[model samples]
Target: MGSLSASYFERAQEVIPGGVNSPVRAFKSVGGSPLFIQSAKGAYLKDVDGKEYIDLIGSWGPMLFGQAHPSIENAVRDALSKGFSFGAPSYNEVLIAEKIVSMIPSIEKVRLVNSGTEATMAAIRLARAYTKRDKIIKFEGCYHGHGDSFLIAAGSGVATLGTPDSPGVTVSTAKDTLTAVYNDLSSLRNLFEANPTDISAVILEPVVGNMGLVIPEPGFIEGIQQLCKTYGSLLIFDEVMTGFRLSSSGYQGLTNIQPDLTTLGKIIGGGLPVGAYGGKAEIMNMIAPAGPVYQAGTLSGNPLATSAGLAMLNLISEHPEVYDALNQKGKALAEGIRQQLSELQIDGFVNQIGSMFTLFFTNKAVKNFSDAKTSDTAKFGIYFREMLNQGVYLPPSQFESWFLSAALDEAHIDHILKASRIALEKTLMA
Candidate 1:
């Protein structure tokens, strides 16, 4: 809405595709020009026009402590002082690796990458090499980055843009990536049965954020784990969105469902561009110099990323209460939103876990992507703009999850709820 942002976007459109690096950031689905942020600090994002909003997107689930936390900032500063890329090993990388391995039960050794896409891509390759199979299973609406294999039925920005499957993905790559319905055991079972021993791995967001915070139905994740075990398929938890945000370790930590492999990003980078995938030692050992399957990044485990991540992990490790606080904050916000919807007699559902949630403009329980599709996207669009006008910045799509950060206090939660009430009311009028 700001003139400066509009000017920047118009300029960017000449060079950057869609005037944004990522698709959803264009606010295509929400029907508005995206706000170009000037800066963010402690739960607030300041647009170039000097307008500030309570940031619920949280940089798409990485700003766990909100933007520019003192500790993380200091960590980055210190690391920056040591120079940038080493193109070689660094002590910070080792320290962060050890922290990750020690925290996440499934990760024996983690190889860092630059983004979630790289992490999931590498994980799949490792899975194929380890299992000696060509095909893998991925759930519908559970995005595992934009890897060619994952573009089929991908969620998040892909879903937001209404392209369930991207065009450039090769048919062969699509064939190797089997699709299943999320939270539906029968669908997964059918995939396994049909594929038989061909599925190298079954990867999913254990608590899907891409399809707007759709939680797994009871025993859904466990069923997938069992099927993977029965068929000798590696069960991979793509916790790019849920990692650390869900629990200290991830959704796996909360459920104790031991995945054969895990892909992590977002909070692990402490708001930096970083990702990691790790699993049973034997399986992970197959990556790079450790064994045969090759995956490398020049910026992998960069000093700055490692330093920030290490600081984040250390904070979480030392203060277990952060999770509790986050959960409480999520509950408060979710409950307030539900209450607002009920009071307005709006047909809406709030699916939440920990600090991640979605308010679907539907009456039905959203257990899968199909249910998620039932949301009134038009109404959601109106609500989104209204909320933005009210200074509450939410994820700019009906298909994305909003992240609550530790920086949000009681006052911030109250402000969000007040904004939600007005937004929901306005949405009904629309």
Candidate 2:
């Protein structure tokens, strides 16, 4: 959008494939080169060429307190003064773990990792070792990072690229991962029945974010819990996206379901790269010096990440209003967009839960990946570009959820609504 961004992208393309470290950031799906960000403060990001846009993606759901929050910055600074990773344990890691355990009832003992992928990979290994099984069941479109076992039918970048399954994934790896439909209890039931007695874990996004904010139907998550219990398989809620974004306790709090193991990332790090997995003490005990199942990372408990995480968790725990505020902002945005769409005579369905939502250009309810695919992607793509031009940032792909931040205010919502109104007008004309 700016001269600096344009020049940077042009130069980057010569070296970086698609000029982006992450595929979605290439803007292939949305059309246009990505905006090169310079810095962020509060609710806006200033691009390299000094163009400011109200950030709605919130760094893919990590900026819960908003970007560059002084407290978190101070925490990171203080931790840096102490030194970075020691390739060993740190007290801040324990403090962050205790904070997580204190906030989320399901996490009994957590093992810190560098990213959501590591957390998921470890959780699966622990599950496999705990159950002595070889297969895992995950819902289609519920992305649990790019782990080989999770790439069977992931959303996010894989969905953006129009590849449901990656090419390099071996049949052996694919065989170990079974897929089921989200929000469809019958599909999961069928999968369980078809493959009897070999599932190590049943993992899913309790509030599906990857396939554009597909909320679970009532009793859907509860049914999965029941099935896992019956099959003696661990029910692992991949809370990587929904963790602190949805509620203080995550989907478990909203759905009232306690998973055997929960994978967390995003907000836990306060915009840093960090992830964690924990569950019933009995199962977690099997993952280390206590048991044979081994999972290790050099930066497993990096002090910087943990310090930022501690600051974030401490603020969220003390102020439950953070969740309430985010819910209010999300509701406002969803309802405002709904009204605008109706006014524009656009056939759209907006699926939302707390701060995560998607505007599907279809009349059909998007409760699963199949339903989401039926949306008018071309139309949404146009709308996305229009919104971006109007200085309202959104997720570049039709299938990615818009991550709302607690930093959004009424004025920001009004601005976004105005932008949507204009964008919808342009989209309808096109």
Task: Judging by lDDT against the true structure, name the best candidate.
Answer: 1
lDDT (Cα) of model 2: 0.88
lDDT of 2 by residue, 182-212 (tens): 9888888998898779999999888888888
The per-model lDDT (C-alpha) reads: 0.91, 0.88
Assess every candidate by TM-score: 0.99, 0.98
Model 1 residue 140 CA deviation in Å = 0.6
Off by over 4 Å in 2: none
Q: For model 2, what is the error of residue 6's alpha carbon versus the real structure, in angstroms, after optimal superposition? A: 1.8
Candidate 2 matches the true fold with a TM-score of 0.98
Report how far off residue 265 is in candidate 2 (Å): 0.6
